[model samples]
Target: MVGAVHSLGGQEIPLRDPADFLSLVQRGPSYLVREWLFLAYAVFAVGEGVGLYYLTRPARSIALWALVAFSAGILIGIVQDAAVVAFVRQFPSDYAAADAMTRRALEPLARTVVAIIDVQQAVANVLLGVGGALYSVAILRTGVASRWFGLLGVPAAVASVFFGVVTAAAPRLSELQAVAEYAFGLVVLWDLGAAIVMLGFRDDARQDGHANSPRHRGDRPAA
Candidate 1:
């Protein structure tokens, strides 16, 4: 939903100029806010992680912290997103008209800002990889909810680990970095699928409990 809304705001800006990036933000303040939804995404991830922790706690205790670690990475990554917006906000309104010395000064600062974001992303990816790997192993071991989930998780973890290395090693490769983005997307999708499975099957557990309860004793034939 957020991505759809952002696309409506404008097309992509070339990175050759910081001024262009600032102007893009200025042109669509709402879009900038939409992009800030990265924080919201992290918040939801934390909620999901905590719930998963409790759900699998009985048999898969270690997976819980790994899920938490993934959430932690996201929380820290939000700051990097904020820094990006801050840079855009700080850029002068008259950047194009600025003297060469001023433009030169700002360019390096902009590059530095982008580099900071890249490095932070690499760290977050690493944390996510660790979390996904641990959680996948736990799922397979416990078989508490769904084996399909475990199967999905194993590959998801691999993708996370693969992309984490890519991001750390090749931060400047925009095209190659897209694979990392897709890998991250895979992890996100797995979480969504797992949530659905959890919700759908919760009623079965309740039914099983009710069937065995003393309340059902009178309904059954005497043994």
Candidate 2:
């Protein structure tokens, strides 16, 4: 978004104005980079969710739900990013060269994309938040990570959901949006912590595997 603002001479482009938005979109390279960055985020989120699903096996059900919600959210995000690149980005050049009548016809399509983007963003945020919270619960219950690390996700989830709801429902609430945005740093922190622990901490991983094993629960071997 900062890149976008910089591209627009430090002024924010209003989505309500298709002309301004397409003008920004016309900067193809930067636009593609920005969209791809979001795509990368979705991809990484999927990986993290799957890893957590396996690592938090002591709380398998919650982790499964978390993985489901997180994966679903990222899947929608991935589709939305693909839609922007495949569909929305194709319009700027066409719109630029079109006559007044043609431009008017194209505007509705752009607006529809904007509305879909907003809806997808909101649903993604809510699902991710629920997933993150559940994953945190699993982590806490399993002792796979430190308490502080697990607790970090709760506020991050809250902030994400709050920002998503407010942005979709009432974008004019800039103050609340700002607060939520600031709090979203926790999400980054939690992601980093989770990755570090899940990858670097072999003892925790081994313990998780052992804890979930039937033989560890004193089950008899099958004949």
Candidate 3:
């Protein structure tokens, strides 16, 4: 693979032409290889979602379910990016001088892509927002092992849902995607914070000991 690429300095970098890089899937052998690579990536993504479900399952049902919904969104996105986009990008688009038949053939693909984009925005963003919000609520209700789970999770989640709706309608707004990325980033940080908080919790035996300690025993009020 290293030798295949036309890297600079140390090695050769692959695809000297920008067009080759852009239409990589339309090419031959490389396209087949990328398909396998993407399949592997999709598998890894599934594993990650399952791991998340396992960890959050112990929380309230709201959190467990929210995470599941969020994972669905992520999977949809993976399929679109890894499979659908690759397949769709292979179609030729420069139809200005093409005959009527060629132009007619291209229009269907264009419409399909726009439709996919509309669905893609909702599944990839909206569900994430709803799930993140519920997970945060679960954390707050359960008292995360650490202090407050930050003040931004709810806000970010709300933004994520809002962006999802707007993006689905507009579909072509590139800036909206960037905004959703930022909102989703915060949601990710919230999850990390939760994991860290849980990691700091003491073992069951230690918690039992603390409960039975003389200080706590003496401090106990009437039943």
Query: In each prediction, how many residue pairs overlap at the backbone (N, C-alpha, C within less than 3 A)?
Result: 0, 0, 8
Cα lDDT of model 1 by residue, 136-185, tens digit: 66777777767788778777777777676665675355566556666666
Error of 3 at 104 (Å): 5.4
lDDT of 2 by residue, 38-110 (tens): 6777778787888878878789789889999989988887887676665545666777788888877877777
For model 2, the run of ten residues with the poorest summed lDDT: 6-15
RMSD of 2: 5.5
Between prediction 1 and prediction 3, the one with superior lDDT is 1
Model 1 accuracy (lDDT, Cα): 0.64
* Cα TM-score per model: 0.73, 0.79, 0.54
Which candidate leads in TM-score? 2
What lDDT does each candidate get? 0.64, 0.74, 0.56
lDDT of 3 by residue, 1-223 (tens): 3213522111111233334333432343444454455446444545444544444455758767877877877677576555444543444335344577876675565556646755775667687677667666665665543325635558867877877776676545654655654565565566566555444543554788988887878875557
Q: What does the lDDT read for residue 38 in candidate 2? A: 66
Clashing pairs in 2: none
Clashing pairs in 1: none
> By descending lDDT, how would the candidates be arranged?
2, 1, 3
